[model samples]
Target: MTPEDLQTALARALTLAESGLVAPGAADGPIDVVAPRRPENGDWSTTAALRAAAHPSGRKALAEHICDHLLTLPEVAAADTADPGFVNISLTPTARARAAIDAACALQPPRGPWSNAGSGPWSDAAVDPNVIGALQLRHAAACRERRRARAAGITTDEADSSTLDHPSEARLLNALAALPGAVDRSRRLRRAAPLVTGLSDVADAVEEWLSRCAVTPTIDEDITARHSARLVLVRAAIIVLAAGLRQLGAAAPERI
Candidate 1:
């Protein structure tokens, strides 16, 4: 599931809860749905309830109420409240896989809200050279992943959600799903830093997944469901990183 999808679910739950809890204008602004700092917390989490709660005493109740509604979403497998009004949510693997495949299928055109990035007389005066270098490395890694997947005889058509059970895979999928939200936040803040950071974070997740999983089996006969799933996950990450780089007015070259 994409971050926008989760954010919409959170907003709906918040609206429903607010109606009963007397929280006025609670969903007025963009609600930030993010990867939890700790995976055990959930696939994603949001602090909208804490911000929406009219009073400190109401935060926990509002969070719980919102989660009650969050559970109703088809994509969400579980939803629960953490202390101080954080809503942690886990999406079904099926949902995440479906979204990842969809993203990979549309990789060529690249997705948007990219219009907000503008046809600017852009400058690098405020840019971080380290961040740019990191992005370049991610571009190179994605290219290598593409090559590896091809060598393994895995393609986008083989991407099956039923086999996507690896923890690292889940982390990478969630990071991909969160890209649009990261882009939006960057646009809203009028700074590319958020988007740069998001891209870097996603790259880190990709590396982590790669380190733990073998996309290319040592033997042809060893190819399995996990390999196919990993291939799709790689493609999805490639799509997202390329799109983010484009948004920053950087070229995401095939050869880095």
Candidate 2:
């Protein structure tokens, strides 16, 4: 199904819940459906009815009732009603992947960064560059120290090296340090979009690249590099989308 179709179905489901057609408290909270971090959980599962069933009736009956209503939707491939009223809805993998891609593509460019330069909702004026610089230097030193310790046959904590000491982390820090000039360059690029249509096309190209990467079963080093490059664009898109949604007083779901 398309993103709009899935959204409409979700809206109808919410309306049904609001009208007491579905169990009470079933549509509440940040996420009613508990999406699994790993793909193995069959896309999305929810214990909303199970949690709501604690009222007059028990969970089992409530779960069965909710499942009955959900089974009417074509997008739902299968609805497994568990004991204590848990309804697990599984969608077709192809459909779910398409929905994800569509959502990513719907994102608009961020409100000009300068719009948030001063004070507004969600301001970042308190950020201290000196403190950030100090932290980066200390983190770089710690990484060097960890490498030395490892070379000396010490059993250093792997977590620190894996995260803070990673080469990518250092590169990211360097990038942030040089972001002011980069922002200026990006603004210039935005203005020159007509003249640089080929480069402008790269941003539009990101969504398709992300979709391809998402469906790949296994990625080798070369493939990984290409995916990583595309992901940088994808992340920028996410930040822009999140910022826009926040401005519109809507909550963007956290990325998995």
Highest lDDT scorer: 1
Give a tens-digit lDDT track for model 2, residues 1-256.
Answer: 4323433454455445524444445455323554334334444566666555446455566566656666787556677766655666666433443343333344333334544432223222332434333333333333343344334433322212112222232222222222233334434544322212222122223333333333112434223332332233334334433433333234344421
lDDT of 1 by residue, 55-148 (tens): 8888899988888887777888899888988999888888887776665454446244453454223332455667766777877787897797
User: For each candidate, how many residue pairs have backbone atoms clashing (under 3 Å)?
Assistant: 0, 1
Reference-based TM-score, model 1:
0.84
Show where candidate 1 strays beyond 4 Å. 18-20, 101-107, 110-126, 188-190
